[model samples]
Target: MGLWLSCVALSSADVRISVTNGAAACPCLGPAKHTPYTTMRRMTTRSTSGRPRIAVVGTGGTIAGAGNAADGAPSAAYTSAVTGADALIAGVPALARLADVQAEQLLQIDSADFTDAQLLLLARRVVALCVRDDVDGVVITHGTDTMEESAYFLHLTAHSAKPIVLTGAMRPGTALAADGPANLLHAVAVAAHPSSVGRGALVVMNEEVHSARDVAKVHAMRLDAFASPHGPLGLVVEGVPRWYRAVTRPHTTTSEFDIAAIDALPLVGVVTSHGNMRREIYDAWVAAGARAIVHAGFGGGTVPEYLKPVLAELCAAGVPIVRCSRVGAGPVIRNASFDDDAAGSVAADDQNPPRARLLAALALTRSQGVGEMQRIFNRY
Candidate 1:
């Protein structure tokens, strides 16, 4: 059961590869076109017997970054997402031994630069790959800056039981002890593992596997920056993944979100409520075409007493308001002492401000009612 690559040139610049039973088609991994079938040029490699077929889609981040000559050893000041998917795959030779690996370069940019349209496109690509009979799992190489948000977006919309693992490095690949190769290897391992199926989208880094909904990048430069406050679902040690618990949240195939039919997401914004927070910030977002807003409030989603009236007024004006916490870990309770449910506001259980914004945007695409928005938050 060895992997084999069969290439067919659709055009002079485009090549389509069919990797026997090991890995499926290797088309262009560049920016997605109007249709999902457009092909691009990339190399493909085969694998050993009885290996799972894994596809690695590269959307650059620190894992693909490169340092300048002025930077010291293990360079910290490198440009992100400059490296290609081919180089990343070649850097981790061990990946070839585990599964039939296929590589594609989708985008080359910092994760922080990820736009809503790109997120939607990525979700569409992941869903397309998962539905294919040959692709057993999908591994996304992303920047650590906004990996959690992207992972969560895919988690809610992917609609697949096949493993979708996201991984990235805090350090550049050119660094003395680059973490990219190892993280990519672990991601592939998790993607190929049978246990990873039906686990929804996962973030694999520093040997830890976290559910997308719970994982966050808490540290700026540390290699172990990503963690789940509720603890990780499992870990990978020496290329073997061990489970500690199963994710109980409704996600993936169980989620009501469907990205396939959505071409564009509704406008949503996030405003942080702080000490002496001005009401103008909220006004600006609404003026800027925000259909919904996630107020990243103080502890447990509390807003200043002065801002309450304005929030209620916005709700009356038909913009849905979602309450979320800036403090990072606690659940924002609906109709809690400070939360006014009657004013067309909803609470985001444990989702942070960015994630809450995504949910709000997605929810708005389906319904505008506060109760329905709240139900969407509670279910997802």
Candidate 2:
């Protein structure tokens, strides 16, 4: 179990420290049951009071879980995907004040269990919703585990200029001080705001609005989990989105990739570097039908001297190799630690391993040459 919280406070007389530990297991674990209210339905977009019609699509995560039997206490013991989209929307009535919100139950599985088929289905559904004449924006409720990957995938594929916001909680909704309601409210607020247009997909969590390309989950168990190395594009202050910066990279309407035309994503493998690594692992991944590989290398995307020949051989054999740093932040500059041109490998810039895999998979659909692949990485 991980340390849940540690807080320090200072007063006139003394200093006080408090500590909390997360639950080892969910006490309320049981078979999942469907509630009658959890069904998907569409509502009229424009009402008597015209508001930006926002669609709230739910794909289960910790935000919709009910782990503890207790009513008002924080506990990590819970089953995920227990709650439904309608219930989540009903819990946050303030969402209606921000926009004409409607709930659509897309899936009720943990995001770690989320499959490539489900991802393609969700992307198609989101694109369908965004193009509708009634809908103005879309908000996705997802698991924090893989939220950044999904956000970046949508950022690359979805061509709509309307806002797409993704948000989730670190704690279950039934827990004390559950973060789902507030995060959802902020997500809807950012989606409805006109300022969010043309910013591509956004991840709204812990009151910060991050562009999908830059945001990554930095902490495993913290309310402020998601962060951008370039700093957040803005913050949500009391239901209003305040802007500070903008995304310069190509995304959404500016991007060349299209979700509707992509029926499947190519298989891309990621391997991390460690002490005394062997070349057989790379061979196994390639044999398993990986079209490309992302090497999550040591600092500065350095490869072990012994393993370099194998990577070079793979690149020469027509499989594209991408060199990316395993570190949390920083770019994998081309030809910095190794001669990328000589090895016929591409650099991942500042993108992390998982993101590099997604981009590599998408890039293969258009072209497979190392030069074009590197250009795609550089431009996107």
Candidate 3:
């Protein structure tokens, strides 16, 4: 688990671990043998006891799932969110060596059932905890289904530089080789690490660290399910976090959005485009009180020729539209395949449909202008 520091060449933008008073320091691997950047940054211990104080906020998922199998065997059929946060921490006793951990049960429900109100509550709770003097960082245990969306929302809304990490498991906690304990431990370790500060909200799964804005769930049942299209920011090996890169996008303290100011998230609906698409579906969303619409377009966010006028009509009626790609990877370039300018629509940039809808909802809470919304999508 030790990094080959002897072969690494240091550089200006490079980061190094500085373990003080025999305390463990967050470590990372350098690019080459002696990486060369003129400036160097060191991560040091914060607490007097040399252990960072970490808060574990739990929103139950498969990590807390329990199975009803005879003879205590793992089974596919199980009940989700059957356990609490304290139990999860107790299951991973090794976390005590990493940080002074505390657990709080925020919610017990499936990620698929997570509502906008619940997301708001969680974000507010996390931001509130981040400002406390006793807490150094926070780790969230969430369901894999909508973890990325929730994490991204926090990334844009959290006002602190303190580390906020989200983690979950692909298998139920009652399974034979449940991943919850290890994932929770790594999440705590990453949250406690000083190097994780200022990185914005992160998702730690399969022992890998990913920026909240980029990571997505690609597989349904595999242990290694979460992945980032822009690639993972770093990795956690044997409870040690090794970072490879940093997020360039505006996030956390740099974000303009604030959790305190947001009273309620506006309704932003998503409509995925497909062959022989129907206009009624799009119309229904708008009629159902959707303030903004995110069209999950096909290939470069292209709109069907027939539905163009319908969308253009809606845009003219004062509703903003966002063109986002339905594909798994790549950016949805503005005015590439679709005439976003003429239709008064904004491109989702690199964000997927659901994420685009989230950003759109958040952006609408502040402004509804096409240009400003487009800029928000671009910058964030």
Candidate 4:
């Protein structure tokens, strides 16, 4: 009996050792990476070691880029970003003092590859973290590529009291005097500061804070790559926030659409009208699977007459359509230019094509039927 007991104890010890080694090898079992950005939550550490435990969720973008070749170009940058959250934070020690930081990798792909479903997933995860008590706020280190889309999605959907901020470096970390550390350190400072709350999902860059909805990539290859055509919400100077105009929309922990009872996303399509436009492009997409089509019409939502017959057919077939202007700014009028608002067609006045597309898709996804879809767009 004593020999049998010793064998059992030995077996247990060996099992534990194996488990420990396995845990150490895999990332999920170790010190949580990218906590603030992911859907999953982690244990509160006693470390008190870093900033205030602000989770840095890593969604792969240029932010996670590493030079493909060694000694290739110090100006051409590279990082062993096997992980984005911890790796970025590790590079910026200034983050260590601004907030208790935990890294989490949500989506580690280039932001350009992101789709509607991915945006939904990221929004869901950010909302999940905001509802938790242990987490103070969240910061997303995203690729500047599609950062605006994700930011706007979060701004429109997620409900949160904590500050949700997205930041990235224009130049790679391998570049001389890389800009990432400074941007990240400032992002952490803004994420931890109290004034950042109540504002919608914000993009912090070049020490400037811009609303996700109003901000866009104005410069092609500059450190100040993003610009809000209307202007910035505020500025972050040496780790402190100062706001000018008060954000008035129902956002941050107070949005019905943020946590509304909606699950499956509606089938939406984007159809751009070009010179000598043919109907086949629109017809093929409708035949494929598009429930609603956002017609990227010319100025003021006007479409070529050649395609009008097809659009009329589309309306007859019961596919809901919204006329969104391809123009970067301005509202899409309901019937002012299309000459068909009197019918089933709708307009997305003043909203750019992308934002209009998102609104149209989301609106259709919510309503029970086509009539409801039109009503959703009109109501909004």
* C-alpha TM-score for every candidate: 0.86, 0.87, 0.89, 0.78
Clashing pairs in 2: 26-77, 67-78
Better of 3 and 4 by lDDT: 3
Per-residue alpha-carbon lDDT of model 2 for 231-283, expressed as tens digits? 99988864656678888999999898999889898889999988889888888
Q: Each candidate's lDDT (Cα)?
A: 0.82, 0.83, 0.83, 0.68
lDDT per residue for candidate 4 within 1-380, as digits (tens), equals 00000001123112110112212323332221232211222222223442345778888776677664456675445542344678888987656546678888988787778888788888888888877766767899888877887887787788775789999877677666567778887787767664566677899999888887667776766889898756788887435555655555555565446634556566678877778777777778787888878888898888786677677678778787778777666666666766665447767755566666777777765664656655655644
After superposing candidate 3, which stretches have Cα over 4 Å from the reference?
Answer: 1-48, 71-74
Candidate 1, 273-376: lDDT as tens digits: 76778889889998999998899989999988898899999999998889999988989998884656677799999999889988898898898888899888
Q: Which stretches of candidate 4 lie over 4 Å from their true place?
A: 1-51, 68-83, 368-380
The window of 10 residues in a row where model 3 has the poorest summed lDDT is 1-10
Query: Which regions of candidate 2 deviate over 4 angstroms?
Result: 1-46, 71-74
Best by TM-score: 3
